[model samples]
Target chain A: MIGVISYQTGNARSVLRALAAIGAPARLVASPDDCDDIDRFVLPGVGAADVTMKSLEEAGWPDYLRARVVEGGAPFLGVCVGLQVLLDHSAEGDVDGLGWLSGEVREFPSSELRVPQMGWNSVDVKSTHPLLAGVPSDSYFYFVNSYFATVGDDDLLATTEYGAPFAAVIGRDNIMATQFHVEKSGPAGLAVLTNFVNFGKAA
Target chain B: MLTTRLIACLDVVEGNVTKARRFEDNIVVGDVETVVAGLYQQQIDEVIFYDILASAQNRRIDLETVERVASRVFIPLTVGGGIKSLEDMHLVLDAGAEKISMDSMAVKNPELITQGANEFGRQCIVVSMQVKRVVPTAAIPSGYEVAINGARVFTGMDAVEWARKAEAMGAGEIVVNSIDQDGTHQGYDLTITKAITDAVRVPVIASGGAGTVAHIAAAVQEADVSAAIVSSILYSPRMEKLTTVAELKAELAHDYGIHVRPIVAA
Candidate 1:
């Protein structure tokens, strides 16, 4: 079963509906108890990093997600702010993140481009992974964010350019995330989620 | 590289997508869900639905329509009109809207903009301005006045100043809807649109006037807007030749040299 983490900050409903639309049934895992029988997990978020971090911390999600994704080696996916909170720190509210990944999130330089780079932009894949299997090269995904992750090249799976190239997709081991809204993006995005549910199945 | 966006603005009345000229004389176009789903299939960059009668009639926005559309359409959805408080914003967002647009309510209580932004990040709050070209005054130095209640009442706030203030107050995006050009189909009011876009750092969407592909191209090239909201030429029955989102994006890319999202072959 697929468990979509719901911390009252992310658009879990949309994510749930999107998953169902692609023939991948899922349920909202609001608490750790709801994570039972859930082999695959998805964290979908929108809003500030600080705010989302606060919600996750208050709801005791960090430890549960860490145990499930980091230690258990289950397939995981994060979207937008969901991707940011997995890093070590963020410049959004000068807040420390989950620290599962050795990286930091910084605001895009507003002098060169709009702060929240809204709308559709294509991603350039950096590595072959199951999460981006069917998604075509140069396929645009919906992005509405003011910050991007700066991670090591080992974990960087894809990069997209706004003012400059930023990490649009990241993956290490069983953990994967995208700075864009995979559920809200068009066909390309749906492909990512569909690939995610079937990530380790083929193996 | 980031591309300029082409947005579809649906003016909804009584749960049906309506086409109007200058915000009056509405004509029912089609069911809201079907039209929106079709636009999504055409690869429209984003979609904004304004509940035109919600505020005037003092009612809540149609969340059913929002839920229906957002469920089927996998793109950013922004809903405006009748959003007065943080609770209303929550309801809309819970209904699957990515952004909440405040117009007259923001003008009445400016704190609502900041409050919503504080609660649900600035990126989810969009301050929509109903602007009309008026005589330049000391108070309205931009030669444009902000209108409220669907352009029924004109506020003394300057359009350019409002755009800047909205940004300062944490509005992530601004929609400068020209009352004069709304449904007129002539084109966007570039004068005021350019003024507001220049005054604010946040993404400004040129709305209220969109007739042809050239009009949308002009908004992007001349005003330097982030997006252009097109309505009439896309699906209105009044139009002699209705265009698809794919055709418009193709024209802008091929002729005007404006970069848009590459079309995903069906």
Candidate 2:
């Protein structure tokens, strides 16, 4: 059974529905105890960085999730604000993150481009990853966020254009994340979720 | 590399999908779910559902329609119409709406925009304006008049200036609908659209006059707006040949070099 982390954020139900669409059985797990017997885990969020951190702490899932992914070596996938929380810190709030990856989240510089970058945007693949298996180099995914994670060169798997190139996808061993919403994305997005499930099965 | 967007607006009344010309003559279309599901297979970028009956009754947003559509459609969903208070906004957002648009309420209480932005973030709140172009008289200059509640309330405010105020109050986006061109299909009101687009920094969605594919292109290219929201032409059975969003996007991509992805079939 695949476990999808259910914190006080958006896109949990949509993520579960997407996994189900790909013939995967996924359940919403609020706490680490609920994820004891699950095979892999998925973290989903769609809100401010500060609020998400508060929710994770309130629910007491951060330490549990970190152990599962770091010590237990369980495969993990994150989306939107979920991806940002994996970094060391976020400028959205003055709070520390999971520190799973070496990076920090910062607000996109305001210009003619709108904040949140809401709508479909293209992704440029950087390296080979199973989670990005069938997705095209120019494939577009639905995005809705105000801040983006700035990962190191080694951790970047894909980059997308807005005002500047930002990390669109990141991965390191059993951990993976995407700044875009695969559930809302069309065929290309479903393929990403399918690929992640396939990776979970292989692990 | 900004691309034009094609949107379809569904007016929901009493849990039924309906369309009105001047906000008076109502005609029932197909089932709201079926039409939405069908539109999801086209080249449409996003879908907006206006709950026309909910606000007048002073009730919360209709979660049934939101859940039914969100269950099947994977694209972005925006809910509007009768979103007066913060509680109303939360109900729709919790029900799976990506954005909540406010019209009469925003005009009545401008602080609602700031309150919503502070709570849910600005990106989720969209301020909608119904504009009518008025000729320059001795007292007022040649500008756009703002209307609300299906044009029932005339605020006598200029559309451009009101857009600036809405932005200052933390509106993430603006939807400018042309009352004069609505359903006429002559084309969008370019003068008013350009004014608002120039006055605001956020994304502007142009609505109200879309009869043909060319009209959509003109609204996007000429008015320099971010998205063009259409209803009658895209939903009318009489124009079945031109109803499909894929065909419209293809024509745009081929004719004007605008790349738009066709919505995948369910």
Candidate 3:
């Protein structure tokens, strides 16, 4: 069973729909107890960092998720703001993140390019990670954010350019993340989600 | 580089794509997913879903439609049409809408824009204004009166002044729709379009009166607007408007030295 983290942010329902579209049954888990029966976990968010963390804390998801990913060794995936919370810290909020990865989230500095980087853009696939198994290089993905993660380690799987090229996809061990909305990114996006589900099933 | 956006407007009602104009005639478009999939195939830059009768019902956005479109389209989706409060805005955004365009609610309570901006950031909020040209009366001068909920509220506010105020309240962009010229197929109300564009610093989307490719080109060049939003031209097969945005942009560049970015399909 696949479990999606329920917070105040958007994209959870679409993620659930995408999972179901690919013949996978997923449940929306708002609490740690709700995640007990699920085998795989997905974190989906849309808003700022501080508020998202607050929602997670208020709903008692931090403790539950920490136990699920760290102790239970469940396969996990994060999308957009969900990806930001996996970092050590986020510029969007004062609170520290779950710190699943050694990185800090920072805003994409305003320049000639539009803020929020809204629309479909090309992604340059870097590594041979399972999340990007059959995904082509220079494939386009949908992105809508003002901030992204900058990690020290070389777990970056894909990079996309707006004003500047930033890490669009990151993965380490059982935990993976995409700054773009895979549930929204057409056929290529479905391919990435299918790959993630396959990776979870294989594990 | 600033790109010309090709936006697909989804007229939604009761969680479905309710109605659209084809040859100036109302036709029932399919569900949000099917329509969005067709628009995605066209490689449109962005998609806007307007709830025609949502505000009158005093409800939030259609979240079910947002989820359906978000799962299908891989582009920026702006959901509008009954967004009245911050909580309403949150409902749409949480359902995968990239931006929320407030109409009647923002006009009634300007603080909604401020509060929404403070909470979700300005980029997530868009103030949609319906401008109707009104002759100068004893009480009002040569200005446009803003309407909400399908000409429900005739807020004696000047359209240009409202654009400026909305900008001051932290609107990331402004969508100016001319009610008088809507579905006319003649052209956009350039006078009003130019007024709103010059009044605000943010990008202005010229909507409501795009009949042909020439009208779209004229709106972009003469009005100096960032985007020319056309519904009938693209959706109506009987209309001879260009199908691809690249073709239209090229025509505009060739005709008027105005460089417009073409929306490429994924």
Model 1, span A60-94: residue lDDT tens: 88898889889999999998998998899999999
In candidate 3, what are the lDDT values of residues B57-102, reduced to their tens digit?
7766667767777766656688888777788877887677778898
Is candidate 1 or 2 superior in lDDT? 1
- Model 2 misplaced stretches (Cα beyond 4 Å): B135-142, B237-241, B262-266
Top DockQ prediction, candidate number: 1
What is the overall TM-score of model 3 with all chains considered together?
0.80
Distance from true location, Cα of B252 in model 3, Å: 8.4
* Clash pairs (backbone) in predicted model 2: none
lDDT (tens digit, per residue) of candidate 1 on B1-266:
78899889899987799999998899999999989988998999999999988898899999998998988998889999898888898899889899999999999989999998888888999999999999999999989999998799988988999899999999999999999999988999999999988888889999987998999999999999999999898998888999998899999999999999988788
- The residue-level lDDT of candidate 3 at B166 comes to 94
Which segments of model 3 are wrong by more than 4 Å? A70-72, A111-113, A200-203, B1-4, B13-34, B41-45, B57-76, B90-98, B117-123, B132-145, B151-154, B158-161, B167-172, B186-204, B211-228, B237-266
Worst 10 residues of 2 chain B by lDDT: B134-143
Query: Cα lDDT for residue B266, model 3?
Result: 51
Q: Candidate 3 — which pairs collide?
A: A10-B94
lDDT of 3 at B201: 62
